[model samples]
Target: MSEWMVTQGSTARRRARPLSPLREYLRDTFWFAPMAAMVSVFVVWVGAQALDTAIVEALRDEGDYDTLDELLRFAEDAKAVVSAVGSAMMTFIGVVFSISLVAVQMASGQFTPRVVRIFVRSRITKATFAVFLATFVLTLLVLASFDSVDDPRAVTTVPLVQSALTLCMVALSLLLFVLYVNTTLRLMRISHVIARIATESFRVAASMPVSTGGQDDAARLGSATAWVPHEGRAGVLRDVHIARLVRVARRHGVVLRLIPRIGDFVVPGMPVLAVHGGPVPPRRALRYAVSVGVERTYHQDLGFGLRQLSDIALRALSSAINDPTTAVQALDRVVQFLAALSRRPLDAALHRDRGGAVRLVQPVPGWTELVDLGFTEVRMCAIGSPQVCRRMLAGLDDLLLLVPPERRQPLLRHRELLRQAVDRSEPAPADRAFALHPDRQGIG
Candidate 1:
């Protein structure tokens, strides 16, 4: 790899997520969205109550007896409906998500465990959960503040605004229920599942800036000191506070080359970065710039998206499933990601100081490694499935056309291996010839 530009902005002003681990947690967990909705529901309920009181007072000043009687009668009618919503909404929430969870589980099993992460990260799933929670909680709050009760001793008042708001919530809930069901059903279909994963992978790829490699900078800054983990156990490295690391390196008058790439596992006491010249920064400062988790995430790990796409393909190609068409579908996405990625420059990252001196260097996957990751395993697993074999050949041929001549070797190598696999697996010349033929739609 040659030289590359990682960031165009001033290193000090560059965006950084210091609390990325916590942010990632918010993205992956199921409870946070509904919890936020529960809190917001109270605010909406309070505003409705205040509005109702103000309107009632205004009506009484004008002595609008007929209008007041009409509103009171409507509120009385709404009480029964509101009570029904309060009871039904909670039960509905439990039942709906329960079934959704089961569906999610079956999809995950059918595709890959990574689909569960995608499910939790889905914007629709989160929004549906939040709205349902808001509707349920808001209805309860509206019910508790009901002023037009049936008790004779109780002073009666019409909660006009509350009644309307309650009805609106019910209507929205029904509308969202339809949408939720549609979304849940789509999740079960194989095509939609792979397409969704591919879409997410593209998002991750777009977030990454074009680069070549930062090893040249690291080479110039020789004889470095190592900064090891300050505390905590080992985990798969997820996020790095890049701005903070640059700041620390600048302050210490040293260059930092991150030792482990994102998604690389690091144990305690292992070197996190090599401090090239100058004294090492405080342990806490360096430690604070890094975060580790039990599992890999798409937050910064670009390969994680490919890993997920590949997992689904592998699962479909498994002996138990024996579903080559599904594998072909996954390969279609994998090829798309690879083809798009190949057209861009990808190597390592560079973080520079205010003076334009490279202060931090982080290595990323090169094109060769990425090509291997995308095709190597799939080619091996495509043995008995002629449809998958044809699709893999088509994917390689498509990539060869999209990428430059220098990047064609990886594709060509996979091509040879694929042909050999077909020759070895299929004894009949007709089947082997069919498998060797490149078909984008597999058998189609």
Candidate 2:
């Protein structure tokens, strides 16, 4: 059972990777372009026949091919002309259809199965096909009429005029198709160029350093202390048995002001927030707070980083709203932001010496260590929203009372401090009221 489970997990991971470039190209080309071409061919054939009929009636006074023999000969001749003209028209229409489909797909960032379905529904393929068919039918009708001209001299003039008209129609169709195709293709290429630019910008942002301090920085670095339960169970983590932890230390006193915001890259042992001024005793409480806070901060940073990445992806999809180059530049900025967030370094400055020789900082005291352990467990509670954070903190305050008096004294003190901080941090009720009543701000 264990082996099977492991194999299944490995298979899922393999499936998650991005499709190969060759596979992507083939899928798009075969599904989108070829489908459009087929539709265009059918349309061109119908259109030529319709145009041929109209021209024939306009040029000829009456029907001359009354007998079966004359009618058969005229039919053969007309078929030849229609087939020739329709083939050329189909080619022109196919090019335009293919271009338009590719352009829309590129702009939308929908290089997936779902996107393909939407493209088919857009009807560019069907519309082009219909137009080509109409043109073909019209051309064939006109060519058939010319075959009935009686006088020898009239024969030369009528056929000559019909051929000229047919050529004109074909030329116009080809010209229109080429122009449309070129415009669409250019737009699609522009969108792709913008996406590439945005990707590069993100890479640059990720390369920037998160801290500049030498060994001193390590002491300031935060620590991931515990896991927390998630608020809801309907989405990504629902029924998954995993929860997202918040930075408890961040809430207590420390805060992360670096890039990537939160919810980005976070490893188990990384420091996620900076430690601020605090009491030395109740070492256990401090340790617990620090550990929980560090974990929470990392989780928050990870979330923020992921959000930024999503924004960049969205910008790529919206390239058609403006010039492709301009969009690319905007996306580049988003990418840079993401890069900066992900480039944070591990803490390496915990051993800074105040004077002569460098000395190791002592491990947190036992009492403080115990407090830190409890804090770690609480942090794992995964309080995400501000409301949840408030609730969790409130619950911790009540729970601390259950601890024996000796242990509880320090914790109770810290809990009171945390409560006071939360009170001070809460936005003023008036501010909330004002937000709800925009008119109070003098807005019409």
Candidate 3:
């Protein structure tokens, strides 16, 4: 009877370790970069100021009086320019990002709220903000380093190095602004959004192990004991710490099965993982392996990309928007996502240890689930648009050729559903028949 219990030690005493909020904060927040920029500016200022002082001292020793006078004049003149540049950057940050953020909010509304997340996580967006702040700080430091010609205090005659660093930062800030504007503009374009999401999906797919065939032993863990309960704030399961879990499981010579799929909402007290084939190891290790956040991320959740694409298509098909053209464009990427995976081997669920023994069984989405997730909602909404209808049919047909025969069932079922939807959408015999014909380019 004791053997049936997943945990061997006292259950009440041990608790699972919650994933690090600091790690998640760094991963998902917008302010980290700008805050980091402040620190970076100070560090650079220290080093560059030292160099400037050393160079000034050496020049004075060499009796370079003419160069010293010129540098002093330049430093005096640069004060106002640096001051203006510093203040202008502050205004630039507030105005540019405020407007861009508002635009991002609009894009999120038009597509999915995921757009804002994508925007926040963008390296260019972060870099632009960081550099802008760094430049502003650099200017401020440069201004401060300038000697008061009125001061009878110890002062570096020429703040040449600090000024040069300021100029470089200012130039970089300008270059990054161009990139930020371009990226923001691209976010507003539906085609670009879809392409970006699809590109991410492909990147995730490329990391996952390609499935040749069966994960036969995967189901052996079905009757396993649910051992670990979530100990943190309830939210969407973002991703699992796969390497850690596998390492721990291999050490214990046990198999760990994740109970919830990535992207599933997990609440406190929910079973995080099931212990299969052996005694549960330390609860802390298992608990720390999972990350839960307010919303889903694309890191390990393959469906998120398709979900975003479908959302765009659905929004385009809405009665208010009634933009079938945009809907068709969204469907283009949906087809591309399915088509890419159709030919390539899908991911395997059973994660193996270095010794080739099964250590973890992840609940990866099967082809059927992927098919349903990719096409189901759009199919229902797309019926009214002949453009969408024809494109979907053509897409299913293309997937049929790419997938193996055993994988053909779902595609055929979707094809049949589309035919039925066309029948219902086009009451006229000729119209229904025309809509049934597969065309990748919609009407063309």
Candidate 4:
């Protein structure tokens, strides 16, 4: 391979790492807790040693006063103080972790398993655990200093300053513990989770590249050309490096059509992309240009966020859960996300290189497909529930007003489907009529 190809391959691999759930869990902030604790312990030990030297020198140079006497007393009781701090910190760490684990378990059970990812990735939770562990490590280090210098007349026997600093840290940890509790409570709510997902999906939809409705020159070329199959393990397609793929395509003087859009699963022996030109780019270079993972991430996959909220709503509407209110809230957010999407260009599937030459042609779901993904499953689950049916109809009607003329047809179609669902599910004409019309509370 050429030097530039090697450089591009490395860079693409770095950017296109598949953020699967296990990878995400291992990469979460809590995983760094031990490193934080070790660093804290090292710094605290160095600082304590320096302070011990300074205090001993000050006492030696200056006559002993009442303040000096108090310092001496603390030094004498340094082991006890360190022991107490270490013990207390250990207890606090256990309590905090227990509470956090309980919250995660409750969220996973009551909500969706996907919701647990939010808590695991929480900065507050990670910082809480890191600080708590650091405090314990610092105390143990301070406690070890007692064996280093045992003579009262020594020039490195004072530990008052270190003890005071550790005490202040304890206070900070306690404050963080309170804030963590508040965050846990807020995250447990269904509305907050749906809103967060909606906001993120909106941002992702808006960030998609704009296209000029240009056709790929390689589209015709790929029909008779050789295809490049994925040679890696099976996984979800998380991201694609369009720029690098374009560069490779341009360099090879051919058009490449990616077989899978973001979030689709691909396995070894499946075609990853089809080549238009005779010879394809290096296999390693092309493989590095795409990211595959065990699960999907919202980074570049537009379907992921919508799928999460839809799944949550569908679960809520299930007979086992039977929480129509939660489903309604999720539908409300879905409507907001669809409205935001309608304003953006959803047909930007053609990607070009730096020279504005189209080299990559991949399929992105049009607005209609997205609408179907967001509403289809939820509507099916809501067929028997008047509250859910009303909410879905109202959402579709509201979306129809916001969407452009081209997009309004799909919304209208979904609305009719919802109306039919109400007709079939509600036998009484009066009850069915009430649900067929969009109402805030589905009849109330």
Candidate 5:
């Protein structure tokens, strides 16, 4: 067994380290959007310049009077073409931006507000923005070369080929805009949203290794320990640097116990980590390894995805919305996610160093806790809603059939709880019986 003790005066207060600069820079959709557009602009400019130079050289070699005149005439058309493209692309950018903002607003109001981050981070939206912006820049660059033709002192040059390239870019942007519209429409649908979240949550679950019940053959933490107090402002603890913590603990030959699980919040003076043998490592190094952010992320916090759908279900169940069907759809996703989680072991995790020594002990939510997190609140909020309650019962049955028998006990208990809730809150005996029967389409 692990012995634990914290000295009263041993708590060290240190500010949580800020996120790495490079990571912070890359995570923002705004940064990547402009950077991609700028790179595209540069590449298109270089290609256009090369093609224009080759055309000038070819024209000089031929020195054909008729061809020169035709080339000059084409330059006039190229200028008009590029100018139109530039104006049109600028307008398109504004229109698409407005549409994206409206879509985001609707999604936030309909679903959970956190999902707005998903829309902004969408690759389709970013790619569309990049292509349109790049087209605008290419047009401007082509227009700049028009002066080369007008100048008598310089060798006669025309951007006939580059203008054709700009025209091609215009066509590509239009195609992307069509796809963007399709993606936006899909985002608006409730079924699509629920499915997307379930798929992502399943992916996150698949990435973890099967648990050995978190048992460790190595020694556990002794009574003597140093408590590492939380520093800085409070926020969700999104990730832990278990590997690094293990390495540091092994180097000092001590066990480090992290108090909060991923997705937990830590405020000032909370014991974030307990060091059980050596003095605590430098505050900055330890803090750098732990990530605390404004909101929960899917990187390692699997519960965040479920929370997103749960919010949508709760919103739909609101008095103003009163959309039971939408809540039922959300419950379908909840069942899928919980079924996936049921296959894996969820217990306190123990990470060891290369030397086979237990260096890090971090707490994790067990299956019962996760089941409660995923279902309790929504079921409670959905008490009188027959469609929602029946859907929940059906989901519980499906999950009971899907997962292994060892996991079936909890599902069985939860199913009983749902029945009891329906019995108490639902006044109609016939309605309660229908909900208790577990039909996918609910009482209807």
Candidate 6:
């Protein structure tokens, strides 16, 4: 029997737990019910006073009980109606209060005070002004009602000072409302204007080209040339085209350091890498330096294409110098081809000349050959930063240009290797690569 009783008790406890929501709702309604009752009391009081006044006035004027009795009966009926309305309102207020209490309880631990403060501050000013205006209007209506009262003793005349005070309150309320609306609209307009100006300024800044220093005269150029140290610790070049320049620098036995790693910013007139081993020809070094500066600026302006072009040109130039057969004619032919391509009308077909004449030479085959030779890489990197890898790719492209068509596949394989190297070295964000975790549950 004791074990049976224990099992029953457990069942009862579970049943009780399910009713907690209803119980919580009922508890919350208790506090707000009284407020509704008070409002109902106020309504009844006003109605009863107005009806009693009408009945007394009618009785005194007509000297009859019929109308007075009828009015009294009507007032009683009205009272009953009002009482029913009041009771319904009380129930509704209770329900609302209960729901609010439950909501507050649910949020108690999680609610941030700072967020609450922000909400309160935003609404308090507007709510206070509304209350003040309502009070002022009510006061004016009450003063106007005094003039309509039948009894002379009950209808007291408002003093001039009191009348002025009432008028002042009404005026103040109107003024405050106008001020609030004006200030809010002005602030919103100013904020929108400022935001637009800031957005335009940022767009302009991002589009502007990076600047570089220029030598004013031959004498200044000569002075700038002296700034390049004859002997110093070699520093690695940070630019993407540095690899190509390294090869050129290597031939001259200058200790050329190709700056490895990424995100290093180089300023104008700053040495990207320190040259060492021996005194290199200042004129040749200056030319390389100036070319590099120009390439960097171009990359900043035109993006990766022009940088690659410059790199390829420099590499081709370097290779031609080394080889006996191709040294003289390689640069001239390439330059002539480039000039012709640039001058051709945008709509002109490759197969025909501008005057509908048969072309003297096919441009596509030559262009393809140059591309196959690795000249494309130099061309792309020429307009970019003169980092070692870029310069090296440019050299490879130049070397490819000299290679026979049959050997193009091997050159392409080498270019792929260089591209892989560059990809591996470049810095990238981790979040962009792969996600480690997945969300397990749905969120509202």
Model 4: per-residue Cα lDDT over 229-289, one tens digit each: 8887799887777777888899888878887888899988999888876677788678567
Ranked by lDDT, the better of candidates 2 and 6 is: 2
Please identify model 3 stretches exceeding 4 Å from their true place: 1-23, 62-64, 150-156, 211-215, 343-348
Assess each prediction's global lDDT (C-alpha) against the native.
0.78, 0.37, 0.78, 0.75, 0.75, 0.33
Q: Write the per-residue lDDT of candidate 5 for residues 262-302, one digit (tens) a residue.
A: 88988878888888878888776676677777777766566
**lDDT value, residue 256 of candidate 2:** 23
Stretches of model 4 off by over 4 angstroms after superposition: 1-29, 57-69, 76-81, 147-151, 214-224, 441-444
Query: Comparing 5 and 6 by lDDT, which wins?
Result: 5
Off by over 4 Å in 6: 1-51, 117-444
lDDT of 1: 0.78
Report model 4's TM-score to 2 decimal places. Answer: 0.86
Per-residue lDDT of candidate 6, residues 361-414 (tens digit)? 101112333333334443333221223334344444554565556545745765
Task: List where candidate 1 sits over 4 angstroms from the true fold.
Answer: 1-19, 57-67, 147-156
lDDT at 205, model 5:
55
Name the candidate that leads on lDDT.
3
Tell me the spans in candidate 2 whose CA falls farther than 4 Å from its real position.
Answer: 1-82, 110-131, 148-162, 191-312, 315-444
> So what's the TM-score on candidate 2?
0.26
Q: Over the full model, what C-alpha lDDT does candidate 4 score relative to the true structure?
A: 0.75
Indicate the worst ten consecutive residues by lDDT in candidate 1. Answer: 1-10
How do the residues 1-444 of candidate 2 rate in per-residue lDDT, one tens digit apiece?
233234334443321222233433343343554455445544653464455454444444454424333434555575577668867766765665666666656655533222232333333444444445446654654555454545432332233334445566566555556555554454345444334433433332232222334335434444523322222211121011001001333234332212112223334444333233322222233332221111111111222222332333334334333222232233233323322322233222122222322121212113333343323333322121233233334434544544445455645554555445444554776533332231211222
Ordered from best to worst lDDT, the candidate numbers read 3, 1, 5, 4, 2, 6
Instruction: Report how far residue 48 has shifted in candidate 3, in Å.
Output: 2.9
Task: Output the lDDT of residue 153, model 2.
Answer: 26
Cα-based TM-score, every candidate = 0.88, 0.26, 0.88, 0.86, 0.85, 0.21
Model 4: clashing residue pairs?
Answer: none
Two-way lDDT contest, 3 vs 6, winner: 3
